[model samples]
Structures are given as structure tokens and as C-alpha cells.
Target: MPRAFADITFTDSVKAAQSLYGSRDANRGFELAEDGRHEIGPREAQFISARDSFYQATVGDNGWPYVQHRGGPAGFLKVLDERTIGYADFRGNVQYLSVGNLMGDERVSLILMDYANRRRLKIWGRARIVHEADEPELVARLEDPSYRAPVERGIVITVEAWDWNCPKHITPRYTVPEVEVMLEQLHAEIADLKAQLANR
Candidate 1:
């Protein structure tokens, strides 16, 4: 728990709700979330690097929260440094809703999930949209050429704080690769059994 998270999440309204539920002490010690804790350490960097896609949320001009899924090859999101992370913003539905929203307000929220592992990470950050013409090198840093998508811009996020969500209700899911691995093991076992029967 980073103090940045506690500062925003443990507000009077939230505290009142906690008190109503007689859970006032439920989130104790989160205030101790410090710079070292909030900083994106090696583990956090590793997790973010492995994510192929994430959900980004921004407040629209009309005050509604608009969430868009951003995706690319694995490790598309570049960990520029401890506090900064970015990704190439590929061409998408021409609405530009998220881009417009970020212009009005830089504050953004992101959710990255590893469904196979039942793990999720929540991030709060300020985002900026930079055009390729303006910062080609920065955009180049984030681009995954193999993805073969037209990158209209680069969305850079200055991480403010991050938190790992609990996995209590997450149902484990397996990807094609994971299933293949299991199938290979079963096939090998079946072959071994057949060999034993032949020997008998």
C-alpha cells in the first residue's frame, strides 16, 4: 500500500463507509506506504514488462469514465525508468475519446491482469500524449515493430502509485500455451503407460 493510494482512497467518505461496516481498522498501516514502497522496484517492473495489454481509464469531459483496452505484443509497454512507463499508442477506432480525455485531465488509472495467475495490478498515473513527429525517439523506444500497427502517438505515464489487488475471487484461466504444456505432459504419460503394457 503506497501512501499515495491511502491518501486518495482512504478519504472521509471511504472511512465513513468503513466505520459503518465496523471495519475501521481494516486498512490500518497503509499510511506507512512510503517512497520505497511506491517506487516501481524490480518486481513491479518485471510484472509490467510481461503484460501484453492493459485497461486504461480516463475521465471524459462529461465526467464519465472511459476505459479502453490497449494491447500489443508481450512487453510492449516499456519500463523507461523506475517512475515512468510508456507504450506506443497504435491506430484504433477513430473516436480518440481517451486521447481527448487525457488532454483535459492527465490523471489516469490502469489495470493490468495476469488471468492465468489470477493476479492484477492497479496503477495511478498522469499521462501525456506525444506525437511521433515531436518525439520520434521516445515513440521509437516504445514501438514494437513486429506488431505492425501504425502508431499515431506515444502515451507516457508517470506513475504516482501502484497496488496489487487480492486474488480472492479470481477464477484461474489458462491460455493456449498453458493448455498445450499440460497436454504434452499427458501425452508423454500415456505413451509411457503403453510402453509398460507392451513389456508386460
Candidate 2:
């Protein structure tokens, strides 16, 4: 866990809960660590680049949190730099709850999961909505030509902090491509076994 994450997330109530649970001592290390770990490193960049979808949570002016799932082709979410990441906001349900929430409050939280590997990353950041009319070049950079989706706008996140979560309860899941590769390996093994039987 990064100190920056602890700094941003470990509020008084959270610390109180930790103390109540007798885990306060263990959690103290994150606060005392010298490295802030605010910037994304190589490992974080690779993981973020590989994610096709992420769950974004935005708080509205009414104090309610709205969580939305944003997805596209693999690597649709671009790692603009160590401290920044963005995605082309494709036209989806016209409710536009997330966009509206961001208008009131810029603070956003994201959860990116690697279900097959049972790994997840949590990120906190401030998001800015960029319109094509305002910054066409910036919005264009986030679009994936092969995805074939109508770009509505661009959501750029200036990352504040991030932390990797332990994969304890995450059930392993596979995408179609991943399942196909596993099936192919199993078929090859079966073919090799049949050939050995034939030779015998």
C-alpha cells in the first residue's frame, strides 16, 4: 500500500475502525513510509494498459456515490504518463450520471480488475472532462480507431494515489480468448497421448 493512498483514504473513521479491530498497528506502516508512491510506476503502467474496463465511482453534489462501468477494446484506457491516464468516453446510456457528477465534484475513484489473475488496483484521482471542441487533439489521442464507437468526450484523470489489493476473494474468471488458448493446449496434449497409444 502506498502512503499517498493511506493519506488520502485513511480518515478518522477508518482509523477508528482499524483500532477497534486491533489492526491499527499493522496499518500504521503505510502512514509512516517515506515513499508517497503517488506516481504510477512501470508495473502500474503495464497493469493499467492491459485493463479493458474499470469501475469508476463519482460523488454527486447530493453526496451520493455513482459507480459506472466503462469498457471498450483491450487497452482502451490509455496511460498518458506516470501521473495521468485517460479514456475516450464512448456514447453509452444517455443518462450521463457520471458526467453530471463530475461537473459538481471532480474527485473520482477507480477499480481496475484482472479477474483471470485475481488481481485488482484501486486508484483515486481528480478527473477533467475534455470536450472535442475545446481540445480536439487531446480527445483524439484517447480514441481507438479500431473500436468503432462514437466518441462523446474524453475523461482524463490526474492520478493522486493508487494501491494494489490482495486477491483473496476474487474468483478466477476467463475471457473467451483466454479460454480458447487453454482448450488448444488441452487438445494438443490429448493428440500427443493418442499418438503414443498408437505407437504402443
Candidate 3:
């Protein structure tokens, strides 16, 4: 199908979003000034990092934005310039939802939060997925000691606008050790259930 047709279909799908969300603020509940009053500088750009916890937003085929948690090495996120960030795409279980979204649309958003300090940074940009194996720039960024595998592709985000969120007093919910324990328990439960089914 032509790109225009896909865009038209996506547009039609989102027409009901406002009604479904029950509010006119359908886009992540963020409000942007029309007159471009807010501006981000170099000092502010340096504060956003992957280590602090980041969320990546990509548009589905239906034009709805899907957000996912992004985490890895701190250097996985490179501030190419004051208004650009780049990161490698590591191999996962092969469910490339974000990559699929990028293929159809390059626009994306990233939100990084420093929970301990109650700081949050939201970034909106265009993303380009580089799939070539021998791309020099991608290889250089993947050379960081923290990355265990060679990156198959990289998502380059060119920041268009940014917003800093205010502090909200919320208690910490989970810790690293708790996550591991929960996973172990779930694995054991699955194994037991499988064994019982085998005997049946």
C-alpha cells in the first residue's frame, strides 16, 4: 500500500480517540503552548539519560501511541547534540513492535525520569532505523563496554520539543531483588503446572 493510504487509515482510526479517552487531551495528557514559549537549552539536555529510566513512544498501525519502558546502559543513550539522542537496538525475543512502528512512521517520543530526585524529561523527535550491519556510526556507539551484543540497528531520535514534569510524591513500588524473586517464583509455578499436566 502507498504511504498516503496508510496515513489516511491511521488518521481515521484516531478520530475516536478523544471520545474513548473521555478528554480532549488525547496526546499523553501533555499541554504545549501554541506560541512556543518554552525552550530547552544545552544544560537541560544533559540531564536526560537511559540509566534514569526512559519510556519510548511509538505509533501503532492504528495511529495510537504505544509507550514502552527503555532500559540498558547509561551510554546506550548518546546525546548527539543539544536536540538529538541516539541509542542502539539490541536483539530481543523477536517481537519487534517498536521497529515495526518505526518502519511505518519515524516520529517518536522518549520520557526519562529520575525517580529519586523527582525529575522527569520528555522528548519528542523523529527516529530513523539503521539496519545495515556495517554502519560505522552504529558500530561506534555499540562499542560501549556495557553492551554485550552487537546492535542490529539503532534508533536515532532528533529532539523537537521537551517538557520537564513536576515532582509527585509516590512511594517506591518495586526493587531489583523483588523482581528477581517474583520471576523465580513464577518460573517454578509454571514448571509445576506443566509437570501436572504431563501426568494427566
Candidate 4:
């Protein structure tokens, strides 16, 4: 049997929620529209698009939280509409724990943080899976360089609530020169290996 939160009375549920997550701020609830302060706006959408990766949280059959990193295009997340966002599910090795969890329960939370920019976006929603054969839009999104063949499905999230996370105190750095040198060395090694194989 599934662990049922539905069995708890409304008052008990409220108390439980507060105990678990701290006090209930009027700006933080299930419905984005209900919380005027937390609602996602145009600027929020742009910020999310700029993020490199997002963290996804799902509840497994045992009700334990399962979290993972989801990465792809610069703004792999697309705002399908005011209340919906679409994300492509990339190919991976056969452990489909997240997909299985989604099948049983759709509620999910996504967090995208740009440590360099000191910005973040938190999205709470319910997900619906769309098989590749059924969704042309998903197919197109998955066609980009970030993914390979054999996409199982795509997830469409109906946004319940979304908010901007407070900025953090971290600076960003890049190592362009080091990366270029490494690539050059790798190319030379590959050429040497090819010449040896040819002589053999």
C-alpha cells in the first residue's frame, strides 16, 4: 500500500508541513498564482534559460527523495506556456528510477542554480510523460547535440509554483588556455597512434 498523505486531516497536514519545511510563508505554496511574490515572470524565465544544469527531485516508491542532475542545451528548459515547462529526457544507461517514480507519481521539483551569476530558480510542478512516438515537439528538442538516439520519453511539467532563489556569494572562473593545451596534446597522441597502427 502507498503511504498516504491524503489520510491526514487538513489541520494535521498543515502542521506537518510547517514542521517539516519551516513556517509557511504566504509566498511559498503549491499554486504560483496564489502567491503573488513567488510567481514566475519574464525575467525569471530568462534567468532559468541561462542556467547550465538543473537538479530534479522525485519521490520513489518508498517515499524517499531521489535527486539527480539534468543537463543539456544552455536553456534546455523551455517555457511551453505560462503554466507549463517542457524538458527533454536524454538517453542514459538502463537505470530508469526517475522515470519509474514519475509513472507512479507526477509531483516533482526542479532547481536550477547559476553559481557564477549568483542566481537560481525553483520550480514545483506535476509531470506528465510523453513518449517519443507521440510528441513531435519533444523529438525536435532531443535532436540537438546534447542527446543521442533511443530517447525513452519527455517530461512536461505543469507549474504549480515557481520562485527566484536568493543570490549566493560565489565567483566564476574559466580555464580556456588549459583546455586548449589539453586538446592539442590529445590530438597529437591520436595522430601518433594512427601512424604506429599504419606501420604495423
Q: Which one wins by TM-score: 1 or 4? A: 1
TM-score of 1: 0.92
lDDT of 4 by residue, 8-99 (tens): 11266775786678665542333223334333578877876665578999998899989989877677777766777777787677698889
| Cα misplacement distance, residue 21 of candidate 4 (Å) | 12
Ranked candidates, highest lDDT first? 2, 1, 4, 3
Ranking by TM-score: 2, 1, 4, 3
lDDT of 2: 0.94
| Candidate 3 lDDT tens digits, 85-166 | 7877778778888999999999887777766456677666789887556577665663457567757787777666666655
Between the candidate structures 1 and 2, which one is better when assessed by TM-score?
2
Candidate 4: C-alpha lDDT: 0.70
- Name the weakest run of 10 consecutive residues (lDDT summed) in model 1: 29-38
| lDDT by residue (tens digit), candidate 1, 1-200 | 34677776688998899889988776766766455245688988999999888999999888999999988888998999988999998778899999999999999999999999999999888999998889989999989878888889999999888888999898888777779999999999999999999999
Q: Give the number of the best model, judged by TM-score.
A: 2
Instruction: Candidate 3: list runs displaced more than 4 Å.
Output: 1-40, 50-52, 132-134, 169-200
RMSD of 4: 10.9
**lDDT over C-alpha atoms for residue 9 of model 3:** 27
